[model samples]
Target chain A: MNIISFLNILLPFGYAVAVYAYGKAFFADTPWAKSSKRWILLSVIGTHIVYLAARTTAFSHPPATTVYEVLTLLAFTTSAAYYVIESRTGNRETGYFILNIPFFFQLVSSLFIKDLLEVPEILRSNYFGFHVTAALAGYSAITLSAVYGFLYLMLYHEIKQTRFGAVYRKLPSLENLERMSVMAIWLAFFFLAAAMLAGVVWLPQAFSDFSYADPKLIGTVFIWLLYGAALAARRSTRWKGRKMMIVAISGFVISIFSLTAVNMLLSGFHRFN
Target chain B: MNLLCLSISHHTAPVEVRERLWLSPEEIVKTLPETLRLGCSEAVLFSTCNRTELYAVTDGRLPHESLIRELIKQKNAGSVVHESHFSVYRGPEAAGHLFRVASGIESMVLGDVQILMQVKEGYQLAVNAGTAGFFLHHLFPSAFHTGKRSRTETTIGTGAVSVGYAAVELAERIFENLRKKTALVIGAGETAKLTAKHLRGKNIGSLTITNRTQNRADQLARVLECSTIPFDRFRESLADADIVIASVRVDTHILTADDVARALEHRHTGALFLVDIGVPRNIDPAAGKLENVFLYDIDTLTAMVDENVHKRRAQIPAVERIVADELHSLELWHASLQSTPTIQALTAMMETIRKGEVEKNINRFGEKDRELVELVTKRIVNKILHTPIAYMRNGHDAGPTERLLSVNVIRRIFGLDHDNAKRDDDA
Candidate 1:
């Protein structure tokens, strides 16, 4: 079979394995807890590598030519971020669901978008790789962190209710989740800032007139500020647990809207349309 | 033996009762043996600020119910206890409960993480007191193993954890390198003291402790190897401090906008960070609105701590799986205990039958020639018992019953288990 057909099959199979493995890791009575998750992680990475190779081979160029390629790259970033957060936080359960869902979309997107599509002239730049990759990486990490934060908040509520039995038995210590989310947000902040910085630096040379407040630009900045606020709130404000989780989730939502919705709809300088 | 656990934790009982019931290591050593003498084979006393639990594995013949009641009555003489005063789980269930407890599954704060060490300490205390017998020795190590397994294998022990650690994390965010930073603790209360200790552990270049009682501040300072400042000089110290943790009990906002603005004038442009851990609030919320000023109140910190608390909660299933996996091996060992003696008795009976058969058979061969035959018979018996005995000891079979039953087919060949005719029906 052709590479597209292979990827179409392999990618979805990987996603299925990831979901099943993650579920087994979360609920099984055996050593599948670690092994299953590790297998899923390996499968995702393997599939992504294959997908990248196929895309690169098909395009006869690097895989950053169109929105589809960027989406594919973003899928890889999300998986990478999820694994990093999972290892760092040691939180395999909550993060599993968050990590698996992104691949589902990426896999679906890939199946249909495999026929080489032409990119808008504005999209064909070396800076495109830096911008899309950084933003998505940041976005993925933020989403993972947001999930961790939500778990933290739920556990905190359970503790407050004075009903610490079954659910309490399953969660990580609150302090660990809080620390992990903070770390995730901080890492995302660094990447997002880098992405914005790259865009702004390259804007003047690339385009005749680059608006300072392009929708994507403005949205990206808003996410940066929101994350900055989260960091500040956590720092001087001592923002933790539920509050931190809410902020993380909110920040991820903003990122999604900025990166996807705004780019698809509004006639902004950065829109794919 | 009666195995019981009498506990007043952050659950059924409040902090006051828990603290009152708390016992030190010295106290555990003194009390454990006495508690065991009251009718237990093993006694492990776990007492911490958040919980006080007494776990005992005793003779099954002991009056487990009244014995625990009397112990609690003696311990909590003046205290009010209803019918639901303490929870009592028995047998394998008790073992499972304690395993979970040691694994931090039964913590009041849901993955508090310190209970495992405390459980270990309690086990050690029982061992030291000579109250932990073979059963307890086997049981406690399993519990410790389970705790370790749970912590390592599961996400329950992972993520944004620790309130004090989180506080330090927030502080680090303000000043990336704490080694060059100065930290000011504004109270001598538990939270403040803990925050100070966490900061100290982080090696924040200079630590200045300030409390209403200068002596308390000095005491912490000595322990932390830092200096102390007067409570009145808190505002004055704020400017020099790169991180300020306000843990004092003040009804009003101690650090006002003007106070922070003044501190900012003397502070490095991006350095100063403020944390208010006081209940009625310490630093004014409005101070955060000021340029280059970052202020966090107690409510905010608590919120952060709570959020992380939730995330860790989500990881509980993974941690529990770790605990359960380790507990599986332990259960196998425990179940083996039930059938071990039966296997031993069966093996002994079979060996006796084999020697008897050899003696009977050798009489026809004459004395000198029979010696070699006796040696051969003994060697045969040893060979026959080796695999089954080894497997049973490793907790494979219900004992040698299955192997011995199979050997009935070769009864004439090995001449084993003649007495098994009597015990077979009973077995």
Candidate 2:
């Protein structure tokens, strides 16, 4: 009915159109279709920014209280990250695969738009805001790394099998995909470390009885260690190509589990409404 | 007016015959004017390693066979190719052939891109020599447009089909990005140098050249601005390289299965692509079975090239459709030119009759009335001629015989042929 509500309905539809356009461009290999996909994506991001700005203004805090709100925020961060990587690499062929994540999250967010809730006092700190934003960005980067890893393995198998089908012609070179995955992993490691630092600093102030037994805290530490090991292996060991790709992909799966299972199914101080 | 093309390509003539008929730049310069003198109003001579084509336009004054024979005789006094060996096409077929040639459909190597540049050069030479007239000036641009459309719209020019290019393409497939990958050339022979040049063009991270003769390797390295490693120490560099090109002239295998297995163990990561372009196969065929080692001998590379060539060949039907579309448009233009002389004579006759009648009626009226009468008579003549002029210009798409019959009837009724002949003589 209002601007925020209208944008809530429009954002998912916009993503749907962009996804369709990107898929068409990927298959048809038309420059015009690709350009249209880019413009549509930019406009969707614009609308998302407006919606988030309005929600924050109305609530007197960032939209980090509810599941739908976090989903919406994740959608925005993931799309932004994809835009940056796609621009840097000049590789748009992976858009259809990568954009699907944000599309699904945005759709879910829109479906639960009526469930917007007020933030609790402890969750409204600047430290909490920084932690949530950084964590989302890290998760988005890890997701991208996983996507590239999957593409690399697929192309590698296709080449090894000598199928030489659409995948062989359309996918980026295996080396390029590997490089992109490594770059994404590095970005993910940096942001995840920042989020952990922010969370550790905020713990003493926000909780009267902060403990190491919290599921969210334990999951976050586990993911950090796993990715750290992956990065260390990449730098030190001769574990590259398929081994490195598998590491990145598994790291993404663990991050997703921590984000969903540890936050909802398990009791933690980081739980949302 | 008529357009004609006389061509002898690798398909129609043997190499000896093509060599005899080939035209050098100096020969084209010397013989182009002679070709024009033989009643060719315009001409473009295109000569490449695989083909030599002469596309010409004439005013229907000289026979096409005589013009072709005289030109061939000038190039080779004792011509081995009979006139029949030179395929001839007239009218729209001639335009279609030029389009096909420009678009690389007629290339010995399917979708070879070099011929497009050669076509542009030939057209430029014809223009500079003052042999290109209205028809050729229009034809060349349309042909170029068709060539560009076919390439962009189809997958005819997508992959690498030559041996040197195939090596580079395979490297890209293995590593995805060559900018961060190193390449090692095994010998200082022509194939090795060519493969190194192709790799360099891809902006590889580094290039190392090694040969049995250190002096030759250094010479080549200096030219390529790359480093030269000792021939014996080349195996040390192999562990660091992403691509190894073995083109040495040794009868024995330069790289054995055990050697590559050792290198693979040392280089624990990434795939090592070995291209054995040498005849006796420098890399052992068994080495290809080793883990993370990809060895492609000459036969394997040739098979890849053949596969790519077949892919390009599959695109010929699409290119031919483009050629046919262009030819149709060109035919409409050419047909428009056919009715020009008749239209000009008809307009000239009408103007003369209007002026003569105006002079005879001048004395029957006062000065003001005579001026008004002249204007009215001029308008009447133009009004009467408008339908016929419009019909002539717009009727170009009609059947040729029917259009010719209509033109003949108009000329008979208006007596335009005599006027046109007389006007030509006066001019």
Candidate 3:
């Protein structure tokens, strides 16, 4: 197999190994878990970069050209975001909970992922690349927010019920979890806002078929407004705590619906061939 | 292989019997010199409430009985301690036992990390008495290294082992950092005081103690250096506290569902950890149903503590692996003691011969050529010695007798004298 194909086959296993290592570190307290888990994750991200680069060079199109390639990019960006947050916060206890997302994304993408050496002229535009990168970054941040929100809710219930299990002992404090969730939401909002702006300015000039009322565009903008309002409400002291986490998690679900529903069920220019 | 251990531990003896052999650090220092006189070249005495073990490397005799008798005599418990109370380990097994002890695998509490420091102090005491050397110097440090490896490499020391600690552990799980959270302890009883003390030890932001008996509450607050709230008005301050510990002796629930709901609404905080360690139930069971209120009674806390203890027990094999790994390395080094002197002599004699031959030939060459010749000859010698040195350092897991025979065979083949081996070491 070519390097791109080889990495495509190898990518999911890399994440799976990272997932196992993080699990062992958090749950079983294995020796190699803590010292090497972060490096394992970083190596996977590095390998993924090589895979994306190889695919772009071989197929002569950026990774943003196909749904499968976009999934891999999403996986890459999500893990990279988690790594940055972990390094900055020095809170690695929640890595096990957070890593499952990228693992699932990469696993599915690797299975059905294709190599595209050539694409339509519009797909080659730098504007489309920036737009897709921004959108992927935003989606990755939302994934992180959802994971942290889910951990917060788990820890929240564990405490409320006085169940001092692994979730209770290994997770960060509720305040910290809530803070991280909000931070991810804020990041998602900014990236998505930029993606939408790029789309609005570049779409009409690039695609005669593009419409303002297209389902994917409208759904994405709608998801953006949903989080934007959540952040604004929290800023104004109207929403916080368990309720805010629920909203962030709900936002991820709706975004997933938009990604799948608008791309699969609805007819839209976002379903580029 | 000369190493030996005479141990009287809780596993082999009753507490009454074990305590008789206990020695203060000073007493251990005093007794260490006597151990060298017991046919041992080096000695270390480790004495605690759970165990009293004398580890020594004898020059010729085992003297396990004599060491036991001396320890019993030192404690004036000759009538109490019997031969059955002592477990003896010899050679690598002796090193392995000490490794287990240092790593807390042999501790009464499974992974008692405090035993590591105690073992460290025992080594220091032996050093102070000037009875620790060579084997012990390596052995004790290896034990310390084993202890460190076991702690860092396993989950043996991670969980809470007691109910009071478990309560605090639950709180820690909720609030990532307890330094900024306030604690409100209801009642000035011992349970309340202990839980309060644990909270204070963790450096909680503030503490407010309340009790029906105002005088008792004031006394406890003064002792703990915290403020006191009136028993009735304590409910008003509940919203300010992130952790509420209820150990008050009361007939009914001190905190009902309504009280918790109002607190959660008023606090504007994320969560509240309420630990009820009272004899009779103090906090309402219904309060645990509240969204942000976490209520843990004594039984639940005990259950969590039990689970943590089980987790620690499950880590025994992991710690044992560390002990085994360290013991193997120590045994290799100990085995080297047998063959190192011979290898050193061979290298020294070869160097002497090389220097002699170089001096004889130096007049035939210029300065640059002579230096080059010396370098080439040295490299040649090292290449020739590589196999022998590697074998002597670590070729296999050689027993003492095997190692002795190997070293003797090497010495005979190299024409190396035992005394000639000491020159380089002494230098």
Candidate 4:
């Protein structure tokens, strides 16, 4: 393989190593391991950025039209999102679980990259690029929220059952996990809203005979309403902590199912080549 | 040089005996010089609630037991202490014990963070008193480094082990920020006071202390620099309080389900955490079942502390590895002290012989030629001495005994005696 493809293949492994380091730091309490994990993650992001740039130049459009390219973009956005959150919160303990999403996506994308095909002319617009980027960012944020929710429930059950195992000791406090989940949900809601707005504004101009009944559009709108309702419920004090965590986790699961069904099986304008 | 440690800790002595051996700051100042006068080459007196250890470096003339007895007698004045109350460790074991103590492995609560600071303070006090000499100057910093490594490299100091600390940790878990929360301590008991102290240390927004007796509440409030409410009126403040620590001792429950329900009604929008550390369960258990009300009693807090303690205990092997690594370096430094003088004497003797032989051959050469010949001969002599000197300094990774035997063989081969070795040390 050429240099860019070689680095692309290695990126997933680098993320795997970073995730492993985070786990070691969490369980072994090795301070240097956390720092090493961070640096390795940053290097992987740098290499991924270079690879994306190379692909964009080679394809004469943004690298968001093919299934593998979209998957790669999602992985990069999720990891970047996680890195930002980790830097802000100084909470590296949850990184092992949160990073697995990006690592898996990148691994699958790299393995199936040879199957990528040419995109239709209509799918190569800047508006479509913005729409895909915004959607990927929102999905990554939802994934992060789901991971935080998972950690919250795990710690909550551990505390309630008095297990006090490795999860109990290593994870952040329940309140912290709840707060982080809420924060990620808020980001997800904002980005999904922006993605929907972009798609709504661009569809009529690009297609000239736009239909609102597209499955991807309906799915995106449904996911948006779900998170929006979850955020609204959070404003009322009763639907907080555990209730909000469930909402975030369920929203993520529905979004993933919707995205997969729309991309793989449904006949839609948003389908990748 | 003999390193010795005489310690009386919670493990070795009861509170009564430990109290007798406890040295206050003033007592340390007064008695530390007396310890030096009693023929200790160097001394550091470390005293905390859990342990009191006096680490000394001394000449072999003074008996370790008698010296410790004299130092204790001088410090305690008329108090009688049995010899069995104190445990003595000498040489490498003494260094190891000090390292373990600094690393908090030997604490009553495993992996306490306070002992390291206490160790540092003890070393500083010894330095201030002009009692910490070369050995302690090396040992104390090494112990501190080991303590830092143990804390960072292992999970030893990761969690809260005390009930009061666990209560604070729970409060943190329930609330997003302690700075925005108010704590209501429901008794003037010690546990309540400690709980309040821990809350204050976390910089909680405000604190309210309540007791059946108004004066006791006021006393505690004054100490904690917070306001006090009449015992009957504490439930009114509970609506504003984010955390309620009920440590009161009473027959009936101080906070019932109805009371908590009323408080929750007033709270309206946030979580209310209740920690009942009292023996009789100050907060009703049913109150914990209420929405947005998190109640934890002493058993729960104790379980958390026990879990944390277990986690820290599991890190003992990792910490021990760090201690072993530090001890190895320290022993190497100590061994070099043994081998240094012999190495110096051997180098001096070789230089002397080389210079004497060079002078006998120098008369045949001119002045400039003599200078060149001297430089060449000096370089040759140094190159010849380099291998043996390096071997003497660092070849043996064995204990001091074997290293001492090796040094003795080198001394005999070089015809170096104690006087010549002393001269080399002075040089």
- Fraction of native A-B contacts kept, per candidate: 0.00, 0.64, 0.61, 0.30
> Which 10-residue window in model 1 chain B sums to the lowest lDDT?
B398-407
Give the interface RMSD values of the models in order.
11.4, 2.4, 2.5, 2.7
Report the number of clashing residue pairs per model. Answer: 45, 0, 2, 0
Query: What is the lDDT, from 0 to 100, of the residue A55 in candidate 1?
Result: 66
Candidate 1 CAPRI category: incorrect
Ranked by lDDT, top first: 3, 4, 2, 1
Candidate 2 residue B405 C-alpha distance from true site, Å: 7.7
Per-residue error for A213 in candidate 3, Å, reads 4.3
TM-score per model over all chains: 0.53, 0.89, 0.76, 0.90
lDDT string for model 2 (B89-188, tens) is 8877788889999889888888878889999988888888888889899999999998898898888887888788888987787786788888899999
DockQ of each: 0.03, 0.59, 0.38, 0.35
Which scores higher on TM-score, 1 or 4? 4
Docking class of 3: acceptable
Candidate 4's DockQ: 0.35
In candidate 3, the residue pairs with backbone N, CA or C atoms under 3 Å apart (3 or more residues apart, or in different chains) clash, namely: A59-A117, A173-B176
Which is the leading candidate under TM-score?
Answer: 4
lDDT of each: 0.70, 0.84, 0.85, 0.84
lDDT of 3 by residue, B1-427 (tens): 7888998898999998887788988788778888777778899998888998889988646658888887777778878888889999998899999999988888888788889999999989888888999778988999999999888888788787877777887787777678888999998888788888988889989999999999999999999999998888998998899999999778988889898888777765667888899878998899887766778899988888788889999999988888878877776676677787778888998899899999998899997798899998899899998988887777686755576678788888877865465665788
- lDDT at position A34, candidate 1: 55
lDDT of 4 by residue, A118-232 (tens): 7678766888888889999999999999999988888776665556677876788777788788888888888999998998898888986577998878888898898888788
Candidate 2 stretches greater than 4 Å from native: A115-117, B65-70, B73-82, B176-180, B187-232, B247-253, B256-258, B264-270, B276-293, B297-303, B337-348, B355-415, B425-427
lDDT of 1 by residue, B273-319 (tens): 67877888888888876644556666656666677678777877776
Please identify model 3 stretches exceeding 4 Å from their true place.
A1-34, A47-62, A93-123, A154-177, A204-214, A232-241, A266-273, B1-43, B46-97, B152-155, B187-190, B197-232, B314-427
